[model samples]
Structures are given as structure tokens and as C-alpha cells.
Target chain A: MKAMQGYCGFLGLLVSALLVGFLAVLFTLVWVVHYREGLGWDGGSQEFNWHPVLTVTGFVFIQGLAIIVYRLPWTWKCSKLLMKFIHAGLNTIALILAIISLVAVFDFHNTKNIPNMYSLHSWIGLIAVIFYTSQLLLGFLTFLLPCTPPALRAFIMPIHVYSGLLIFGTVIAAVLTGVTEKLIFTLKNPAYSTLPPEGIFVNTLGILILVFGAVVFWIVTRPQWKRPTEPNAKLLQPNGSTPEGTDYSITGDFGNVDKSDEDGEAAARKRNLKLDEVGQRSTM
Target chain B: MKAMQGYCGFLGLLVSALLVGFLAVLFTLVWVVHYREGLGWDGGSQEFNWHPVLTVTGFVFIQGLAIIVYRLPWTWKCSKLLMKFIHAGLNTIALILAIISLVAVFDFHNTKNIPNMYSLHSWIGLIAVIFYTSQLLLGFLTFLLPCTPPALRAFIMPIHVYSGLLIFGTVIAAVLTGVTEKLIFTLKNPAYSTLPPEGIFVNTLGILILVFGAVVFWIVTRPQWKRPTEPNAKLLQPNGSTPEGTDYSITGDFGNVDKSDEDGEAAARKRNLKLDEVGQRSTM
Candidate 1:
């Protein structure tokens, strides 16, 4: 299962980057045409107004998500397996969501925001900024805190994982609208533009991004968030004696003494006063 | 100090929102004026192209920030103080920076792509986006992991935090140009438009948004991502303890055990066995 080193988690990011580049060209061309053709000059097409807002905003947010999911910090005990796989998966999801959201944002330009044209995707893009932002906020805390406290651990940890699923799921919002718009556009007039994806292909990207992002967000944010940092050994005694006034060091490694050394019981008994006290107290 | 919440954030938000609104209206108005005046209908205004792009894009991003920052789901542990304060601060900044960057993106209506009036604000606005995106990335990671591992904690974490500060500081990128342009326009033409802040102030908002976005990303992402789940606990356990194999549940109530229920002997045996099995084996 782990054989796919890089492939496992990069699904979201690859798609988003490609979408951003493609959309930049598509949007730019469309706008340039409007400007040249004087489509909205007389306010005849109010829908065009929504395009610039959607496309540029979507692009910026995509950039925002890219950084968060791709480059989270590391943990002490994590092997290369969980760490790399999680990061890759997260990056893939975020990137995909970003692309779908971007496409959804531009739904206005393609007339998808209208009453009849409005689909689930229109609402998704409208609300996508939240998912993207939520993902970023959660990522930051995990990377910066000292340790995930139990109280907090109970609440926050589960959320990022679950939210990841939702975020990726929401990517469908973009795909639906994207495909619908493109398909309809091509059908409306077979005189499709010079654009490679034409109308239908570009429209379909929203759902692809949604699925990609949700999967990625789940894969990365889910496992790493729930993982622990290091051995949290509770020293049963002060200086290994009693919890009386001894400050509990969450770092469980106690002074190089191998915990498994039980064979030297007789000799070690003299030095094991703390353990004995804890043992005796337990027996009472 | 917390008393400053007396609609302090509100004032900034309202003002920023209004400014954004005015700019949008002004952008479209300017285009209409040019069309009616018949100046840009044919040629003379190469720089005008960027104006609509900038004005529209700026609104999109600032509005995007507004929508996401408010609606996104936060980890259960996010501090109310930090979240509210940062939320208001960054959104305000986004609005201001949008206006500021507008100066560069919309330097002049009848000018060329390489406008003759290129100034410090324009440069700052361009660079500000870099910082804003970086902040978003770092923030996401911090929150996703809350308390990142020791490996790159010092480096990556600091970069994330600093990116936010840079974003805040870069507000001059957007506003300064507007200030100077208006000042010049007013001095020579008395009909000086309501220029945005100049120099540092212009880009200050962008810088702020970048910073705010970064920090917020951290705040929201951490706890949720880092929360401990039962599955994660199982994965971390070396012996691969299933539900039936180990009595140690991964519930957050680690210290809430009922003092061994007054049973000492049996507890000791189990604990001793647990101690013996350190990392290689499980008491189960």
C-alpha cells in the first residue's frame, strides 16, 4: 500500500496548479474579448461583472491553500511513512479544492449563477472561502503548539479530520457548475473558442477539484492531527519517587535508565526506592 | 486591554467595506466616463485595462477574505480573544490593501502598461501578494499540526509568523500611490478623487491581510488537525493493540482513573506487567 511514495498524496496539488495556469489564460482571454468586443460596455451583460471578482479571488485563495496543506511541520516520533504520505495527501486535496473553488467562483461569468443555471456548485463556491480558510487556521495551530492537550485534543483533532472530508466533498460544488457551464456553452453555439479545454472540459474541473481536495484534506489532516508527539511517561515518584512536589516532565525518558532492565532486581532494589514506594502504595 | 473591542474593529471594518464599495463603483464609473468622453474607445488608455482588473480583483480578494474569515469552521479550542481580534484586524487590512493595490493596478486610465507614474506603492502591492500567500500556507500548517515537531519548528514556524507581519506592513503598497495620485490630481485639478492611503499605508492593508490570514490560518487549523483519535492511538501503539487486546482506551481522560477502585494487588500486577512490556510487547 505504501509503495506509491509521492503518488499517494499529490493528487490535489497537481490538479490545482494546472487549473490555475489554465484559468489565468482562459479568464484573461475572455476579459480581453469583452473589452475588445464591448460586450458589457453598455451594462447589457451584468453577469460579466461577476467573472473578474470570482476568478481573481479564487486564484488568490488557491495560493493561500497551497502553502498551508503542503508544508506542515513535523513530529518527533513520526516515521517517514506517515509524515510524507500525510503531507502529500493534504497538498493534493487542498490544491484540488482550490481549483474547483476557483472555477465555481467564475460561475457568474459563464451564467451559472442565474436562477435556472444555479446548481449546488454555485452555493459551494459562494461558501468555499470558509472551508479553505478553516483548513488553513487548523493547520497553523497544529504546526505551532507545544503538544496537543487532551481537552483540546478531544475537540480540535477530530474536527480537522472531519472538516477535511467536507472540504474535499465541497469540491464537487465547483465541478458541477464548471461542467454544466462548459457543456451548455458549447451546445449553445458550436463556435467554441480557440481554448483547448473549450467550454465543456473547463466546466468539469470543478468536481474533479472537489473530489481531489476532499481526499487530500482527509488523508493528511486526519492522521497527523491525531498522532502523538513523544513518549509521555508519568514518573510515579519525585526524582522517580512520588508526585508530591516533583514537576512531571512530559518527556518520558528518565535519565538513560532502560525501562526493560528488570533482571537486576536485587541490586537495583536499593536504587529503586521510588518504584518500591509506588509499588507499596499500590498494594495498599 | 481587551476593552478595545468596543467596535474598534467595527470602525475599521465599516470603513474598509465602504472604501471597497466606493472603489468598485468608481471603477465602473470611470470606464463609463471614458466611453462617454470617447477617450478609451479606440486606444489612448492602455493602463485602463489593469484598472478594471485591479479594482475588480481587489474587491474579490477583500470580499473573499471577509466571507471565509467569518464563516469557516474553527477548531473547538480557538481562543475567543485571538480569533476575534485577528479576524477584525485582517479583514480591515484586506479592505485597505485592496484600495492601496488598486493604485498600482489602476495607476491611470489613459496610461500605458508601464505607466510613467510607477511608484513605491505599486512595487509593494506586487510583493505583498507573495507575503500574503506565504502567511496562508504557514498558518495552515501550524493549526493543522498545533505544536509542530522539533525538526523544522524554529524555521518554518518563524517564517509563517513573519510572513503575516510582512503582509501587515505592506499596506503601503496599495494606498501610497492613491494618495500621491490624488494629491497631484487635487493640486493641479481641484477635482482630486478620494485617493486611498499613500506609500506605506496603501500596502499596509495587504501586508496586514497577509499577516492576519497567516495567523488566523494557524489559529483555526491547529487543534482540529492535531486532535487525537482512537485510530491514531492504535497506530502509534507498537504492539498493535486492537479493542479486545488492550484495556488502555485512548480517551482524553487520561488522569481521571478512579484510583484503581481501591484494588491494589490486581492493579499492581497489571501495571507491573505493563512496565515489563515497554515498547516491544503489550500487557494485553
Candidate 2:
């Protein structure tokens, strides 16, 4: 197994994304329970249509798969020629379906008779931000899709990785803001029978912790491409050629090795070996 | 003198993103004005602070540039490559600084000796939906960042384009829902000071038109690419040497006969010939 290198930062973001998802589920349950007995505020809806909410949110959970796929390195080693393409195809389909379904519900719900201040709209708003954060993560994974040029993948990954963290951090800050939102609007007090304590310490702690974690993750998991001139000995190529170039910190390696259309079986085999190395450890 | 084609859709999206941004500015102004006195239903904060809200939002806007940079296509023929990189780089640096500033102010406001419910948190929470949305548009735009492999670009463009409309639609819906958030907690007052009657119709109509336009455009613009064979000319390798035969529609042909990586006589001569072929037109 190859050595597992850097990014102590992903720990924070992974934890935070999971934390937010857990909280969403918790709040979702709370709202559902209260809505059924006509005790909670889902606007004037007789019962919480948890079906739609859950469906959209289930898709959200699927969306987070991008984290697993992307945040970690491409450490899988498979022997099949088309396996990566097949796997990527499946993932692309999954993302497309999930996004389509979730967004459709979002569209319908937004235009429904529900009130905005303290109704399902607010809940959905919070959920949508989380979902969008996860979707960005999902799309970031596209850079790693099968058959893509290594140079192109290398080019997009860092931008995708760091900006993704930024999006996640922004979403968390926004979500915490939402939690406090339910408090500030207490003046109106439309949803809650009584106001929940807007625990300044608790909320601030959430935001800071979330922010700190996100920032560290941003700095840590930031994908550092093997410098361009460095022979890109480990870089990926579309034609499946994996040439072993020396680590050149100089000219000719602009990180864009567009040699996919070229035929080089020897290079392809070398790349295959590298894949096996990464895949072995990742499964471990 | 280039033919007007696939870009119309892009232009439509450009208009939509701007509309959404304009709406955000308008809504921010409205909310500030509406709540300037502080909603009296809850115990109002004795002191006032607007600096934090402004700063967070400003930083968010600064970070928003990444979206613009990532969106528009940047083939070899595109203008001002250096300027594009500069805009992306400088704004990112600025955004980082602003985020730091925002966090400091957020810390201060959250800890202020005032009612937490009526403080800066609520303002952010209420507007978080808009800001998060703006980010989503930006994030989606990044997904469309200039990449080679016309095939991949075509595949990503549709997803990027359609999903963008869907997310934007959802965010707008959430806004409408927020405008009516107060209706959830109470069954009594059908309307409040913030809930202006005109807003309901205007927003709903705007959303409908936007959605209708997006759906129709998708149905009409989608090319039949799933066919098993090249129903047209066989796919040509970029170098015109190896042919990975596939039939694909060319919705985005930028006439790259002489386009290259460097400023040179060959590229200039081609441009001049094209210019002479068709004299300058008023439209870009």
C-alpha cells in the first residue's frame, strides 16, 4: 500500500458535513412529529409532507458521496479497462437523477401556498443550502471522471478542492445563521408556540467551530498538483499511458500533458501499476 | 460577424443571473428598511449595528467573482487571457481578507449585550438564502470553467446550464417562502408590514416566466447525441491524424482554423482575413 500523505484538514470538513446532515435529520424529525399533531409550523399544511422533504434530502445524502470520491486521492487500483468509465457513468447518472428530483421539489414547494417566515419554506431553505453545498462537492468529483486527461484533471482538482471547502464553509455559516433566524423572527413568533433560546454562545460556537474546521480543511485538503515541470511521473493520461517522467521543477511540464490520443502501451502499463498501488491502500 | 447560435442560451443565463443579483440588492435594501426600527413583537435590541451585516455580504460578493471567471467559454479565440486570470486571482485574495473581517465582526455582534433574537444573526439568516443562492450560481459557473475536449465541454455545459436554472429556481422559491415566513407561526394576521401585496404577484410571475423559459430552451436546444454512429462526418482527432469516429453536433464552433496558444502572424492573418470577409457588425 502506498503511503497516505497530507491533508489533516479534511477531518474537520468531513466531520462538519456529517454534523450538518445529522442536524438536518434531527430537525426534520422534530418538525415532522410536531406537524402531524397540528402542533408544529409547516405553514398551514395539515401534516408535514415528509415524503417530499425526505426525498430531496435523501438525494442530498447521495450528493455527499462526492466527498468520499474527491476529498481523498484516486487511490483505487482496478485491472479492468472500462471499469473506471463504468463507475463514473453510474455516479454521473446518480448525480443527475438526484439533482433533477431534488430541484423539482424545490421548485414546486417554493411556489406553494406555504408562508416564508416560519414555514416549510424556511426549513427547505436551510436544506437547499446544504444540498447545494453537497452538489458542488458532487460536481467537483467530475474532474476525476473516467477517461479524462490527467492534465485537465490536475488542472481542475485544486480549484475544485479549495473552492469546495469555501462553499462548505459558506453554507455552514449560512445554516447557523438560519438557526438564529428562527430566533430573531421570534418577534413575529409564527411557527414556534414559544421562542427557543437563541443561545448566543451555542450558536457562535457552532459557527466558529464550523468556520475553523472549514478553513483548516481548505488549507489542508487543498489538492497540490505535482509541480508541472516535474515529469509528472504520477500524472494521469487519457490514452491510459502512464509514463514515468522525472520530477522536473522546470520547463515543459505546464501540468497539461495532452498526450491522450497518442499510442504508448508501455506508458499505459506504468500508469496501470500506479493505479494498483493507490487502489490497494485506499480499500485498506 | 460570427453567426448567432448556442450563445443565446448563455446570454439568457447571463440575464437571469443578473436579475437574481439585482433582486438580492433590492431585497437587502427592503429588509433593512423594513426592520430598521426592529420588529417590535420581540424585545428589540437597544443598540444597533449594521457594519457586520454589510461586511459579510460584501465579502460574499467579492468571492462571487470566481463564478463570473469560471462561466464564459475561453477557447483559444477568447479575449484578454491575462485579465481573466488577474480578475480571478485578485478577487480571491480580497475575498479571503473580507471573510476574516466578517468573522471578527460576527464574533462581536453575536456577543453584544442585546437580545440575540433581534441582533445581526437574524439579518444574516434571513438574507442567507440570497447569498447562498448567489454562491450556487457562482459554483455552477465554475463547473463550466474552460476545459478542452469539446465533447466534455458539451456534456458539462448542459448539466451546468440546466442545473443552474434549477438551483436558481429553488433559491427564488425560497425567497418567496421567506417573504411569508411569518404566516407559519400565526393563523391570525394574514399579512404583516414586511409582506407587501405587490411582491407576491411580481415574484411569482417572474419565477414562472424564468422556469418556462428554461424548460422550453432545454427541450429545443438539446441535440440528438445518443445515436450509436456518426450520422454526420466522422469524429476527427484534434491533430487531424487519428480519428476516434463519433457523430456529434457542433453547436459551439468558434472557427479555430488558425487559433493557437501564442500571439503570432498565422493567427493574426486569419483574423484579418475573417474581418475582411465580413466587415464589422454593430453586434458583438
Listed models, DockQ each: 0.02, 0.04
Top DockQ model: 2
Write model 2 residue lDDT over A1-284, tens digit each, in one string.
11222222334465666666555545444443542332222423322333323422443333344334322333323222233344344445544644444454344345565344333333334454555546455543543345565455433433343343333333333334344333334334332323333333334433343333333333232212121122333345332223211111111111111223112212333444455455666778
- Model 1, residue B157: displacement in angstroms? 35
lDDT tens digits by residue: candidate 2, B193-230: 23444344333333332333333222222221011122
Task: Output per-candidate TM-scores for chain A, rounded to 2 decimals.
Answer: 0.40, 0.42
Q: Which ten residues in a row have the lowest lDDT in candidate 1 chain A?
A: A246-255
Q: Give TM-scores of the second chain, every candidate.
A: 0.36, 0.37
Report the error of model 1 at residue A108, Å: 7.9
lDDT of residue A276 for candidate 2:
42
- lDDT for A44 (candidate 1): 27
| Per-residue lDDT value at B196 in model 2 | 45
